[model samples]
Target: MTTDLVAAVDIGGTKVAGALVDGTGDLLHRVQGPTRARESAENVLRAVTDVVTQLTEHELWHRVVAVGIGSAGPVDARNGTVSPVNIPAWREFPLVEGVRKTTGALPINLVGDGAAIAAGEHWTGAARGRSNALCMVVSTGVGGGLIVDGRLRPGPTGNAGHIGHISVDFNGDLCPCGGRGCVERIASGTNIARYALAAGWRPAEPDGDVTAAGVAAAAAAGDPIALAAYDRSARALAAGIAATATLVEIETVVVGGGVSQAGEVLFGPLRRALGEFATLPFVRNLEVAPAQLGTDAGLVGAAAACWSDPDTFLIRGEAGN
Candidate 1:
């Protein structure tokens, strides 16, 4: 039995992960390295290069037909570049060129991490069988992607489905993205914890570990402020999701990330808020579901990008590259 595989790279603020993914959505070999995002841009690229080197050295490397890279946005797939928000060192980084130089210029599919997640979910998770859907990650930051007409629409720049920066509250607090009332400004895990702390939601433990998880613990213990913080985040997320559904006609929204793991504490309010915002006739049937894939969604989605549309695969030396 011949097993076809693809080399997958997932680049984030904290770490750079790589894997050999088989056609069945299985990761055969994996390696990772710290991103050291605060370091120089060359240092960040070194970490990514290390991941590619490890993957190519595997004996099964020959079975890998292509490479797929999912990086923090905003990514320009058309120009084969990326400028991740968290990694300040990488401003319009030539990611595709770096990967090509390391891997002998194999075909590469570059996409924003959000688009990768949507492709993964569409292939094997919550959005499976749904032609039009939205997939999101609400962790240290919020990000999302879209599926349209039975295909992942990464858009020209590969950052099309970025829902986090969308202004849900025009007159609200200023966001890091220079927008007021962005969904991420209120709904991200970091913001959730910040809101809880600013509102006097102290931790039960005396260590002062005021994390989103800590806030979740407080909410679980019936802390009113913590619960209200989550409610506020949920409301903002609902507005963003509803706006996406209203504009693009998505039928489902699959939410993943650390915040979503809070389960009902977040979803209960998010669903209720969505009911209030997604009131349009076309968007009335939009449904929300939990992402079935965990952290591995990025890896699976990277490979799925290649499998999802082989014809449009971006070769290393192609015009875009």
Candidate 2:
């Protein structure tokens, strides 16, 4: 007897990744290709097709039951379209229809990359076993997804728990999303590095590295400017997480992405800031932890979405069964 599997695709500005995932959340086969983000829309679709075609060549492809996609937002899962900010060439691209032509009649499901991370974490990572949680990616830009009542909530357009764009500072910096004081503007890895540089912080080794990882090293080494940068980022993130918890009532917040790898440098200040902002009785005890799935979260989460209610699947261009 063949084991059931899901063909999972993770589409991002940098790469298009595809994998065959089993019911137990294990990756059986995988393939990846660079995303020609600056090229034409057809080129991007070709990248996705190439990944899917590689998956189809796997011997276990016969057991694949469905295809699930986790693409960078802003995505309209209801309409099977995607408009990732980093992929400027794909404005309102019909990703579902494009991928469907490669997969034949297999059912397809779509969700924001942030939501897919949440689904992956809730299924087997840090948010696992939690009935309610918020999962975030704090990389070049901040993004998030919600898990309410033990189920992944991608919302109507698959962008529900986008905590990054929420205004945490009413009069703060302007965000690319056209919102002032958005969490992404203040707390993303890029912003953290920018803050450090603007504050006169220089790298210890003169490697000319001004990324968040460099800031983390400086913070760990007791550089005041670097420490202040991380502190500000942490505070912004805390405010966003607190607001989400207060409104929706979550038990935990699982953080992923490059900046989250800072370990104590980020989490220490984050917990302190959360204590200051989340003073409410109900939200005071919210737990925050690092994600365990690492880079596989997107692929695993896409498969997890397929294993969910078939009624929630996005078949062809229509939502639900």
Candidate 3:
């Protein structure tokens, strides 16, 4: 009675993590290494491969049936390449081919990190049992993925549902992604802190702790500047989410990541702003909830991608089969 498993890799700017996930979305064994983001391309590749090597050393490696890689976007699932924004050295790096060198003959699936998170949530976390949903991460940057008609839609380039870059404010600031007034430019953790600082918000501490978390604390304490910053971010997010719901008819939006941990500080205002933007009858019932699975969504979602039909992007089998 050998169990089937997927070898999952989560590649980010800070680390390269690997795990063996069973069909039930449980991580059985894990390994990780720091991402040499500033180093040469080969160094970063080596870091990813090192994690794979460690996974292969696990006793259950023999049960692995497929390999799934969820890399920071933008990823080319069709071409099996990745060009992560934070990892400047990898411009269209052959990530699938690189990992294949170690896994050999196993089916390899590639998707953007956002899509991976969506797959995970849809498969077993917050979006489970929902036919259509949007999942987003609002941390240093905002990223998202979509589930349409009960299937993960990574798009051809694996960058669909990138709600962050969608312009919620045409007259807002320019974003690093070369887009003007993108949601991420206003709603990301970095931007939230920046907005607060620019508006004369200061930490109560003499050491000057000026982060999104710090601003969240101030907002909780009724600091006008901090509350305004979060309100602006919430408005931008609400606009983006409303636009997505109006376009795609999603029933739910599962939000996660560092900024989302602000709890009511972010969600309370977000719900209020959503009422102002999502006024259309068809989209008025949209629900937003916090994401479950925490940090493991990346790994679990990568494995979920492997179990999905390559053509339809739908889950093809029972959980943990």
Q: Report the number of the highest-TM-score candidate.
A: 1
Please list all clashing residue pairs in model 2, or write none if there are none. none
**Candidate 3 pairs with clashing backbones:** 23-320, 24-320
Name the regions of candidate 1 deviating beyond 4 angstroms. 310-321
Best by lDDT: 2
Candidate 3: Cα lDDT at 199: 86
The predictions' CA RMSDs to the true structure, in order, are: 2.9, 3.0, 3.1
Rank candidates by TM-score, best first.
1, 2, 3
Q: Model-by-model lDDT, in order?
A: 0.89, 0.89, 0.89
Worst 10 residues of 2 by lDDT: 312-321
The superposed Cα distance between candidate 1 and the true structure at residue 82, in angstroms, equals 1.0
- Runs with alpha carbons beyond 4 Å of true place in candidate 2: 312-321
For model 3 the local lDDT of residue 188 reads 92
Q: Which stretches of candidate 3 lie over 4 Å from their true place?
A: 311-321
TM-score of every model versus the real structure: 0.95, 0.94, 0.93
Candidate 2 at residue 26, lDDT? 92
TM-score: which is higher, 2 or 3?
2
> How well does model 3 score by local distance difference test?
0.89
